[model samples]
Target: MRTAYSVETVRAAERELIARLPEGALMQRAAAGLAAVCAGLLRKVYGARVVLLVGPGDNGGDALYAGARLARRGAGVTAVAMDPERIHEGGLRALLAAGGRLADGVPARADLVLDGLVGIGGRGGLRPAAAALVERIPAGAVVVAVDLPSGVDADTGEVAGAAVRADVTVTFGAYKPGLLIDPGASRAGAVRLVDIGLSLPEPEVEALQDAEVGALLPVPTASSDKYRRGVVGVVAGSAQYPGAAVLAVSGALRGGAGAVRYVGPAVDAVLARYPETLIGRGRVQAWVIGPGLGTGRAAEVAEVLADPVPVLVDADGLRGLDPAVLRGRPAPTLLTPHAGEAAALLGVSREEVEAARLTSVRALAAKYGAVALLKGSTTLVSAAGGPVRVNPTGTPWLATAGSGDVLSGLTGSLLAAGLDAVDAASVGAYLHGLAARRAASGAPLLAQHIAESLPEAWRQHP
Candidate 1:
């Protein structure tokens, strides 16, 4: 599992490490790593043009020191400070000694540009001075951000205003939540971790790697039967959108569930698509409600909630949810909502939820006393407590009609197969995204394509 700590936690760790090390030693270690990455990106560091956007804090120092290293290797390096008086004296001296010069304005041509204007400590948006430097960056230059992209929140991944868009980000010590979640994640093109040797504590956010996800998957035993493997009950679709039921069942059948029992008015549509589906609910370990269910089905949603089994709610079922009723449930409940539905539940605007996805997901989880899965560019799974799991797999092509319905069924199947709320949601999202990437290699794909690719995604593991 990949873990990310808050800015506060990372600062504490950095301070402790700095106290024991010699003065300037910690900064030098960070600078060395930064320089190495830049060299690799340049391929031939000799005669390369490097521009460093220096700031008023340690981030600027890291860039200056790294620039000095490149200058020693015969690269023509230029440093542009946001404020000349506030620049780090030691770093500036080092760069000048190594043949690097201070530049009054951004050069028109450069092989690489280092965004050191702001680091993890900076908040809100960039000041006018820094934003101006960022705007002047030459096109086609490989922009590398030191630590994190400027104007992004290290803790929440929120971008209040103009932020740097980097081709690569070299983070030190630990990953920040902003690097893993959007819209900061989108700004951060690719991320590289540099170990500064700071011992850290539990992370506030985590992303499951492939191996971790494989371990969480349920494997049938030698003595297992259809019933033992688990059955998933799905209540979805209506006259208006019968395809939703077909798509949901398609995902459920491939989600490790031995059998799927479906209920609702779209019975004929589901049967015609999946003949193996058991019509009408019998005994099921979990239930998936909503998804093309249309409006005015609150009673059916309530009926499913009353059952003593895990339930995954999505789409139309997410409307007008009662927090107190969900909190009182005897079994686990997973709520999957896109930004719009999440906004409705939280009584906030969609723009607010999208801007602050981390906060919105956590708020939904705590308010309902259930696991909440916020689906978007970066899928997030969070419960009442514990670290929020960030899904690192997905393609922009996954954003399509009825795609969410497929996710709901897959997650419900995992819940039926005995995975806890968090694991079910996280693993489901991981596979769902991986499947989408496979299904839509670059072109547009239908919702059923994602469902069809689930088996191949599962085969990636043991």
Candidate 2:
């Protein structure tokens, strides 16, 4: 698992480590790692032009010291301080001694640019001076951000205003929530972790790696029959959008469920696509509701909610959800909603949900007393109280119309197969994303293509 700690936890760990080390030893260690990454990016350090956007804090110091290392390697390094008087004294001295000169403004051209204007402590967005420097970065330069991309909230991944769009981000010690979640994640091209030996605590956010996903996958053994493996009940689609039922069932069939029992108005459409589906609702380990289920189906949604089995709610089913009803449920409930649906449920604007994904997802989970999965460029799964799981695998091709319908079914199947709401949602997202990557292969893919590729995705992981 790739873990990310909050600013508070990281700072506490840094302070403790700094107390145990020499006055400037910790900063030097961070600078060394930062410089190594910079050097690697610029294969030949000699004669390369490096510009450092220096600020007043330790973040600027890390860049300054790293710039000194590059200067010593025969590279021309220039430091542009946001506040000349507030720059790190020791770092500035080191840079000057190593043949690096301080510049009043950004130069016309550069091979690389290091953003050291803000660190994990930063919130809201970049200051006017910092934003100005970021805007002046020379085109075509490989922008490498120190610690994290400036202007991104380290804890929430919220970008309030202008933020540095880096080609790569060299983070220290541990990852930050902002680096793994979007829109901060989109700004951060690729991330590289640099260990500074800060013994940290439990992370605030986590992304499951391939091995973790594989271990969580459920595989059938010899004594297992159709019922032993578990059955998934899908209630999706309507006369208006029968394709939704077909796509949902397609995903469920590939999701390790022994059998799928579907119930909805689009039964004929589902049978046409997947004749193996059980026609009516029966005993099921889990239920998947909504997804192309047009409006005015609240009673049907309530019926499923009353069942004593795990339920995954998406699309129209997410509409008008009663928090009290969900909270009183005996079995686990998973709510999957896109920004617009989430906004409607929370009574907030879609922009608000997108801008503050972490806060919105968490609020949804807490408010309903159920696990919540916020679908977007960066899919997030969060429960009432635990580290939020950030899905790492996905391509832009997944933004299709019925993509979410497929996801709802896949997750519901996992829930039926006995995975907890969180695990099912996470694993379902992982496979769904990988499947999309395989099916799309750089081209447009249909919702069914994603469903078709799930088996291949599952095989690769195993």
Maximum-lDDT candidate: 1
Q: Which 10-residue window of candidate 1 scores lowest in summed lDDT?
A: 119-128
Off by over 4 Å in 1: none
What local lDDT score does residue 52 receive in model 2, on the 0 to 100 scale? 98
lDDT of each: 0.96, 0.95
Candidate 1 lDDT, tens digit per residue, 1-462? Answer: 999999999999999999999999999999999999999999999999999999999999999999999999999999999999999999999999999999999999999999999989999988889999999999999999999999999999999998999999999999999999999999988999999999988889999999999998899999998889899999999999999999999999988889999999999999999999999979999999999999999999999999989999999999999999999999999999999999999999999999999999999999999999999999999999899999999999998998999999999999999999999999999999999999999999999999999999999977
| Per-model tally of clashing residue pairs | 0, 0
Instruction: Write one digit per residue (lDDT tens) for candidate 2, span 39-139.
Output: 99999999999999999999999999999999999999999999999999999999999999999999989999999999889988999999999999999
What are the RMSD figures for all models against the true structure? 0.7, 0.8
lDDT at residue 429 of model 2 (Cα atoms): 97
